[model samples]
Target chain A: MSDAVVLGLDVGGSSVKYRLASATPSEGIPEALAQGTVSTPKHDPVAGLAAIARDVTALHRLVAVVVGIPGLVDEASGTVLRSANLPALDGLALGPALSAELEVPVGVINDGRAAAVAEARWGAGSRERDVFTLALGTGIAGSHIVDGRVVDGAHGIAGELGHVVVEPSGARCACGQRGCLETVIGAPALRRAWNRAGGHGSPKDLLSAYEAGDARAARIIERGAAALADAILTLLALVDPGVIVIGGGLASAPHRIVERAAALVAERATFHRVPAIVPAILGKWAGAVGAVSEARELAGCVVGASAG
Target chain B: MSDAVVLGLDVGGSSVKYRLASATPSEGIPEALAQGTVSTPKHDPVAGLAAIARDVTALHRLVAVVVGIPGLVDEASGTVLRSANLPALDGLALGPALSAELEVPVGVINDGRAAAVAEARWGAGSRERDVFTLALGTGIAGSHIVDGRVVDGAHGIAGELGHVVVEPSGARCACGQRGCLETVIGAPALRRAWNRAGGHGSPKDLLSAYEAGDARAARIIERGAAALADAILTLLALVDPGVIVIGGGLASAPHRIVERAAALVAERATFHRVPAIVPAILGKWAGAVGAVSEARELAGCVVGASAG
Candidate 1:
């Protein structure tokens, strides 16, 4: 009972990264006791969770699990509402299934929002009440935390900033719109930009090249940063948060993109209070960390967290 | 005391519209007892309020007054934070000063949000909780009322949609931003389009031409509708409200714009719920009517209102 540990699973399109955190982590102690990653099963998420549970249980006393998905989630029912990339998980009662498998209380949330909760509570945005967290992954994931809680609009679709139409005539987006911020600055766009700029392997490669003073890479990064600034301007014009916390894949190299984007936003802001822009402190583990926070709340461990 | 009427004043750049409403009007009885308009004093808003109060008090038993200004307002201090169009009223503690002048309790609010309060409680948005009210007049004014209250974001500049940059590479705005929605769709733009099309005395003339099936006017209307759709889509992608109430000068031509904008938004929506778009019923009187509501609220008549 004293060694209770919570499992945090960040479910992504390609892989599932996990962290085992103390149920009641003490001050000066690392929250994440152990962390690892596993290839996400293409079709059977249940089997994947079962396998992870089997392995994690053998090592430590597992109490509860919190799962973060890169999609819309029905928090009340713990159902993955819609996952474009991870369709197999969509419409599944993920929490119930996982809870049944692990024999523990399970919590689920949108991965972006999960990251925001982590940042809002313990990371870059801890100092602020209103935080706009942009998680730049395979797709843009946005979460707006107002007064330490993610704003759920009339239809539970508030803070979906990735879909903000940036250019009506630019390009067709997967969301049946033209020129969403996602179309311009999402990971797919970054990959296309990287390939178009003659850099191969990954977005990291493009970032490396840009950092090393490559002309084409610089242009690509510049364009991305500019687009990000445009998105920030839109957000500022509407929400006017106290700070913006950048996370996910792109934020790993904050110096490459966040700096330029912040500069561009400051230059463009006319009637907006230019908020403090900072990279997330939780890094790649933000989703997992935030999921754990939700899990702690779910197990009745966290006092004021919204839901499990 | 039963005959005590509240004076509702809507202070615009060019005119001050006042409405005399019964302080305790029975349900189903007409709320507004009388209404009139006068040119706004260019040099001194204080003198303007004093003149109105002096006249209103002489005619009827005036209990209190509510004022709506087209600008950012510090509702707590009753100070006009910023008014771009009416620079005369900027930085003035209009409520306290006017209360002193009129010798009555005064409530002040942002005109756009005041209009939204009218719509939300007694107009098109009465049936819904989350309402996005877009008042398209000389310049666009916006309000997002979440759960029957206006969302005053950080710095109280939440719903400033006029400055949302629609085109990053478009024309420079007065706000020092490029291609603001204001630059493309505000009154000047509409007037320019009308003149450029070789016909125009007023925007109403262009609207008449548009209604009469003039090709150039139709094109201009279509462009405005498309831009409205773009702005609506941005709003939907972020804060998907339950209903969108279109008020102000443009809503008078609802069939020409609101209907077309709704269709465009519905057509473009992929991951958004197409909300009901309706012309505001209160029309130009919305600000004044809502100002009365705030006056009631300020006098401690409203039990749940945030502030005056």
Candidate 2:
């Protein structure tokens, strides 16, 4: 069973993380299997991913591979529709490319949804039947999971809660919309708010200032918290998940954003059941863990169908 | 088979509608089966529902009964937790009571969700895998359906999109919140807005006046339409349904609210897929139709479990 392990890869803008796990993830993580990371080629992510796959397979007998990419993916066809970070990989058949190079079954998924899958299987959402994970970093993204399965929706883009318009006239978003939740709560938005308030600092510095009781930092943090609370309440009204796992850079900071947002949600959610808000425990390896889970699920389905 | 037909009851504030559907709803409406309505007793809705069930069963055998009510319902426990209009029925075990009297399996659902089930099974949402139905009448309500089944969420109140806050400081909502989607888009809200603009007329009259290019009516309609568009776009970013069915009295009016909403959504949706916004076709019988569908699904689940 140990010899039949699968490889999971999480490809980001600057680096790619990889890990090996047993084909069935629920059993436990494989012992002493070294997790690895390599710098991603800025211009050729597909080739970079194939190299990583080769390096991982050199030491382990890989049965399957799953890659998590930051992009709009057509999972059914294994195509990367659009990736803002890795633009060169746009329109590429990533899964097929990797499978042909590595000679194993391959799967691909959106990175945000991958984080949700990871959380659902091994993090804060593990015990819940329904979970919504919001990743707040340079950009905001989300994933909705029901009964341990991520809802891919009709177009495979169901969990775009970050783009939901919470303010109709606030700020312009990268997606060309105004007042998107991301426009107000994304990390850049928080930094921008702080800078506009006569504070020149990174998001981390801003959080430290907020913790130190800087009035301007508190005001910026309050605005972000309010926007996040509104978005969470909107999600509660729509998705009604059991637990909302907050992940990424901004939420993981010690600024108490999640606590403040939770309080605001409790205050406003009179007719709806307020969900438990907690931090993501899987950390940076969430995407890799979720990719492995997806590979295992795919393998299980194929085996079940063959047996039937 | 006719003797094994099921009965669906939709209990409203002032009346109850009953229909006898075949054990399977996919086969289409039963030919010539009498559908009836009776005035509901002001103080005893359970008794009124029981009487309606008896009346329907008198002509046709009922193997199962499903009731749709306007309130918070615990579907699994067959309890009505709260009802604003039918206060007397609050906290009553309506499903068990009706099942005991009618001698059949019973299922209870919220009326808004019932409308969603009807649309998903036999109306506008029939062809879509993911559908969000928004019922805009006396109050605004919604249901999120994924792969032909309604997502009841963790607390069984997942589709309360009507309560999502659209404006933070706009208007007070009945749910003790300010600026809820219902506060701006419900029929009563539109009426209030119209009346505030120096117009005294029914909702129908307001629509007619808007159609005739009355400036005040247009202003009111524009406000309502914009608020509705914001709510719909919020839903799209969160739920990402393939189609959105607009139902209830306000939606079905001849003033083309759905068309206007669809246009607004198209104008604002840049990155997200704008779902097809259409009016529901089931009309007044939607709740009854949905109740029957739920009963059939419930019956099928029982049979499957027992056989297994």
Candidate 3:
């Protein structure tokens, strides 16, 4: 077994989160030797990733690296197919370029998928074999973990749950679709709905108002919850995961989105086994943790292939 | 290698289809040695299955048997958890009873999942690794095939796509859910919509009228088609299969459900890889063919385990 430490980087819109850990296949994701956040370069993502990698490597003896990008990624060829937030990363050969620069094996994974891997390995989903993790923040995204591995379907776009149109001719979505789950249940959507209902301040305030018996806030939240429940039930019927780990900005709140959705699921689900819907325990660092898990698996595969 | 012939049975609501074939795991499901259908004993499903198994075994040297049940089935223990069509099968230990009588390895699989396995092995999805097959006849049931194996989920209800609520508060479903895909797109639902639109002898008549430019027929068909499109998009976003094979009574039509859903998917899918929507070629015998495939797999597993 390789005892070499590996680096995991999760590049976000505002910052880059990272962790350095020794990849041990048998033990799963271990405690990070060192972890921190860095300001991502606004204009250049590759340079930002490279800088973070260099800084991390300077402090740790890294043998491999995995970078989780918040976009559509072709994991096989290590290409960033499209990154809406990180425009510089669109069509970038992130894996090869980073590997060449860092002189180590580098892997690229979708950030949502990476979070799922992390959850499956060391977080809420650790005890489950099949799990679906949904991140419901600015946008809604998810990953399906089947038999301890995240399923990155034929076109590397498995678990794009947010894009599923819940309402055929409802609100316009950022993805150019009409009434996607994301359009109705994402953080932005919730905020807009709350504001449209004459509620003031942030989502936090809206949650407080809903909890405090504000009728308008209650109606808006219920609508979003119902839409989210519809999406969750759709997933439940399709994948039938043992559990669904809910993460992201909205889910992180106390008794918020996940709780609401869970209630709706119990009230609505029929015949199908209702999955245990729980909050993601890994929080903001889940992407980084999952990136480490992905790196470890990739390194193990490379070693096994070469040895064979 | 045991080259003994196996009998595959698909127990439907009105009829029981049977296929006798020699187990050939290497080349997938081979052409059946003999195949035919029999009227199902409406009073006793177990006796019906036993009669069919006895009839098949009398002619062929059957070493194994697989039965596809059209309801919730616990495949691991071969118990029919719930079969609305065959009430006598509910909570029965079909596998043990059938194995005891037949004196061979017996397997039971969900009919929808069996169709998915058959499609993955011998039909439109033969070349694909990840395939989602939807049987859109009396109901809108589906099965997800990942890496050529049907995913039955942890609770044996992974592909209950029919139960996924598309119109959350629309129509009541037989499964006690409101606005399920089945409530909107099932043959019965389409028939109801067609008849309400002031036309219809059969679903065929409705399809013909819609094709010939009848406004009321077009409206009814379009409503069902839109609901189906919503369900298909939901599946695509969540499972992201390489291809989606549409089968059952409604799918046999030319330029109907599958074509409409495909067009909707093409227009709606954003960032996610749109899967190929094709018609299932195996027709009515899909369940029986898939049952044979399941039996072959089970037999192979038994042989391998014993040998090891």
DockQ winner: 2
lDDT of 2 by residue, A1-308 (tens): 23566778888898888887766545443332658788987776667777877777676667777889898898887888889889888999988987887777788888878878888767899889899988888888788888778886666667787788777788999989988888887888888888998988888888888888899988877887888888888888888889998888777765477788899889877877988888899888988888877877766655431221
- Model 3: reference contacts kept, as a fraction: 0.84
Model 3 interface DockQ: 0.69
Report the lDDT tens digits of candidate 3 across residue range B127-208.
Answer: 8888888888887778788777877776767777788777867889998988888888788887888888788587788889
Per-residue CA lDDT of model 1 for A66-165, tens digit only, reads 8999888998888998998898998999989988887877888988888888888778988888888878777777777876678867788877778887
* Chain B superposition TM-score per model: 0.84, 0.91, 0.90
Please write out the lDDT profile of model 3 over residues A131-171, one tens digit for every residue. Answer: 88888778887888876687767776778888877777789
Native interface contact recovery, model 1: 0.76
TM-score of chain B of 3: 0.90
Ranking by TM-score: 2, 3, 1
Any residue pairs clashing in model 2, and if so which? none
Error of 1 at B4 (Å): 11
C-alpha lDDT of candidate 3 relative to the true structure: 0.80
B121-144, model 2: which lDDT tens digit per residue?
788988888888888888877888
